[model samples]
Target: MKNLKLLKWILILAALGLFAILAARAYLAHRAAPLGPWHTHVPNELTAAELARSDWTGYLEVESAIFTELEMAVTRQLDPADRVPANRYFDGSPLYPGRFAQDWNRSFVLDPDGPPVGAVVLLHGLTDSPYSLRNIARRYREHGYVAVAIRLPGHGTVPGGLTVVDWEDWTAATQLAVREARRRAGPGTPLHLVGYSQGGALAMKYALDAIDDPDLPQAERIVLISPMIGITAFARFAGLLGLPAIFPAFANAAWIGVLPEFNPFKYNSFPVNAARQSSLLSRLLQRRLARAAQDGRLDALPPILTFQSIVDFTVSTRAIVDSLYARLPANGSELVLFDLNRSVKFGPLLHFGGDLDPARLLPAAPRAYRTTLVTNAEADRREVVARVIPAGETTERIDRLGLQYPSTVFSLSHVALPFPSNDPLYGLEPDEAEDFGIRLGALSLRGERGALIVGADMLIRMSSNPFFPYLLDRIEEGIDSSASGRSGIDRDRL
Candidate 1:
């Protein structure tokens, strides 16, 4: 009778614990910012079948319809005072002034002056519009390559669009972009795929898909910037956090972060479902990569060039090394790692001792792929050097670069790898000639907390690369070598 009484007490405690957790979640939901029109009114999710049937024109039509609906929803929901300056949906706002009149958020195609000799399809990252890759696309255009930068579905419209879309929809959109690129370049032209962040995963997956399907257009070369090969394990269970969203009382539980829409090109507000979708995509890609490696199908993959930071807060650098690069079949793949700034002033504070050295991640000798490290020449100087290790070789060649690490900057972030040093929005030294209303990178905000719309973390994150010139030079070198009937860096050198 005593044991039975103890069991009853345990059951009571367990029920109370569950109740307390639910009550806390409900309270937090109630305290959250009220759902805006973009959050409450979900957009149509694109399916693979629909994307396959639609051409670029049909795709644009569907996008226009969604944007129109979003505009109407915003009109009905927000007051005139709340709508004008802060909301991007409204015209004549400082965030999106009527300088262009037409929306610059959509996908764009840039053609060369002459007939295209090569074709390049550029895919932007998650929560980013095609504007992110405009610089690279222009470079490709100047080189006589037809560049197609597609604004992935669920993006460039509203943040709510991402809440409904899945990774399959993203891959389907990639297919459409490739088809358009193929048509523009015609046959016998070198086709390349360039992807940033999440788009990098799509590009890698598409390459894998091409290996299985003979009809798909094969990419001759692949470029990835801060690829999302793996993300945090928390993202795997992010969907569970949104379970309360099923009840209208706790609808705010669906959002991971709700912030003001300040950036014209990217979404500041992030939803829990978006994180879940990205995690699903990364998991699927990892599985496919592993299966392909085991079946020897990865041997058919084209040359891949990747640029990544030694320390990335979003994705795992170790995963990129162990999962992708380690499995590659020496098909002229190269990984360029930007090491942390080990300046003399910050040397003591920096963790230099431990296993933080990225070079240690590689095998003892004769690595299958080439590795390049952009790092400081010594412990005391700000000058940077390029340490290149040729494929299947142990010897390292150190070359001094004219470039010097900026004293103000300590390290590059994942988002910094793509944009140049002179970008109007994110550059450290923003171009004054071009104005994006707000020069985010140049802001030296010094005020009490809560005064800003966005958190301090958003401003603290590094957004532009100082060594972007070297990155562009390396890319152009590869392009020039390819045009001369050679594959990437001379195999003889390797």
Candidate 2:
């Protein structure tokens, strides 16, 4: 009996020893992995100030004033070249210069001596500031690249009573950010542009504008997330395109009111002048498409990767598919469309159904569906759009410039990207709504030229997890394919 007891104790000790070794290996491996949505690399070799503090009370009042003044300046400034006009004027310069020449205190991460793997210039969406891309900038730093997140004028402030910013001002901001990124990266480093929503559209515009510049830096790639390149048909009649350019002072747009769908971002009202600016931008893009269509310059556009959600109510998928993606040069650009409704499945070993799963306390698993993305067609036009509609909803038709555009349409949602659960880091008290910062960061790291698309849910989940390797793989694949002169990417991997 004594011998048997000793044997049992020995076996137990052996088992425990094995467990300890395995656990240690797993922990080390995880730490070595890239920082991403599901995992974070602590980077023991690198040290920076930890941002564990959540308090911002010290700057609350000051920030409020800054916001108000900025908005007021945007509201009152009409001249494009003038930064915050000395006097009130909504109809200012038709072309605005960049604001990067001005200085402000913002954090930056840099690899001062490296040959610079690449430089990425990030532009935030409307009503947002460069700060929104903070997490994204951090991710780029981990990959040994230089990244800049720029603050857009008329953003990060109290709502400017008048929405009057023009597309020129926004474009200028993009130019400024890109120029700064290029300058910091030096001569040999390639430049890549990453933008979200409105910023994405501006990036596209900048790419087009830079085509003829002799001093333009070689562009490495372009990545757009939930890009707001298109607007709904109603917007055409409302302020978006109807009255702003022709009559800058005219303001009779009721459709500018915010919708409940916008509640996710906590914005209650859409600015009037901002809507007018959007109209101007949309028109400019439309003109570009028209020129490309008639003059055969479509091939001159840069290589692009754009992410879009079929279910996004904020921007019209139809416009993106028909006007933007479909208009790309057949040999240069491709679109990655995600089926938002069919996104989440087998979540952490649980398969939930429907749009919302009460048991999971999260939206239902995205239905199981194959992507129908394709771009090269023999016809003059090519489209790659997918839709996922629940029962009882009529499909909306797209109207482009008083004529219907030939398109491929499908069902999906705006928030289908894999966003990080706002509280995923917390044990049980997760925030009700997920945050897309990590996912956007992951996408930024992973994107390549020729257009990449993702559901919003995927974007939110990656902010904290920082899964660097997975994203690096995607980037590698894209770079490899681009080098091989491959056109029209295969959609199976997206």
Candidate 3:
């Protein structure tokens, strides 16, 4: 009778705790501004099976229809309050992507001067459009590779679409993109896959599928930029937080963040379902990767080239090293980690985690994959060097890169790896050649606390990478090697 009473009390306490959480969520939801049509509208996106059957042209047609619906339902129906100058959803606003000469927000294809040497399918991150990878796609074309950058469904449209989309839909869209790439570049040609953030998870999942499904084309090489291999505890239960959204009174519960939509290509507002979908995708990828390793299927895995930062606010850096890289075979994969700016210029102002040390972040030397750490040569100076550790070797080959950490930047960000310094929108010193309405990377606003629309943490985050030239050179080298039918990185070269 005493044990029964104890169990009853435990159950009662748990119920009360859950009720308190629900009450808090409901209160926050009510406190937020009313949801716009962009938050509530849902497009008629194609199903996964439908996407698999559809070719590139058919897929684009569906995308066009979805955008048409978006314009008709949301843009045309925006209230006067939402017609602010900063609103990208407002068709008349300067921030509108449609106002641009060529909207990079949509899917794009770049062709070389003549017959392409190979093909590369580029995938952008969650809540991001094809614009994020446009610069790299152009470079691939210049390198004689057909670059097919697809705009994943639920993205390149409105944030509301994300509320209903699933991870399978994104993968199905990837299949369509690869099919288009293969068709354009010809069969038996070197096929490279590049992914950023959530797209990175998709790329890995696609490659693993290719190993099992003979119908799918295998990637000659895989490149990831700040991949989302793992997520935080919040994302794991993001779906539960949206439970209140089932009631019309608490519709705002679907969104974790609702910011002013100023970015032309990317969504400022983030939905709870978006986080939920990413968590599901990353979880699935982890399971598949482990299964591949256990079944000896990792031997057939292609060489992977990844670029990641030492400090990332969005994704797990440890997961990249342990879950993904550690399980690789001796297939000549490479990880280029941008170490924290250890320059003494910042003094004690810099307060990063202690685990950022290469010794803690990466496994011991003689790793199956090559590890390259780009950091300051001396603790007191800003001059940077590449410390390269070859696969299956304990020795590190040091190479001077002639690059230094920008005085204003202490570390690279999750969104900084794929972008160069000269990028018109995200560049710290954006070029004058193009104008995307807002120069997000160059914005340096200082004022009283809570004066800004966004958080202070966002303003301080580094947007563009100064070390982008080196990243491009490395990618170009990979392109050249793949063109020559040499799949892996040159162990001797830095």
Top candidate on lDDT is: 3
Candidate 1, poorest ten consecutive residues by summed lDDT = 485-494
Question: In candidate 3, what are the lDDT values of residues 71-90, reduced to their tens digit?
Answer: 89989999998998788889
Clash number for model 3?
Answer: 0
Clash number for candidate 2: 55
**Quick one: best TM-score, which candidate?**
3
Better of 1 and 2 by TM-score: 1
- Alpha-carbon local distance difference test for all models: 0.83, 0.44, 0.88
TM-score for all predictions? 0.92, 0.51, 0.96
lDDT per residue (tens digit) for residues 1-494 in model 2: 99999999999998898667545544443343221100110111101111112112312333345444443445353234333222111223211111223212222335535555556787776655454454455556556567876545455432332254456656665665566676676655556677777777787777666654544453556766667777655545454232222332222222244321111121234555666676667778767666766777656554666655434666766666566665555444444454322212212342334323222221222311111222212223332222222222233222121111123112333432222223222112235354321222323334554342323433333222111222233344444443343333221210
Give the C-alpha miss distance for residue 208 in model 1, angstroms.
0.3
Q: Rank the candidates by lDDT, best first.
A: 3, 1, 2
Note each model's CA RMSD in angstroms. 4.1, 26.0, 3.1
Instruction: State the TM-score for model 2.
Output: 0.51
On a 0 to 100 scale, what is the lDDT of residue 12 in model 1? 100
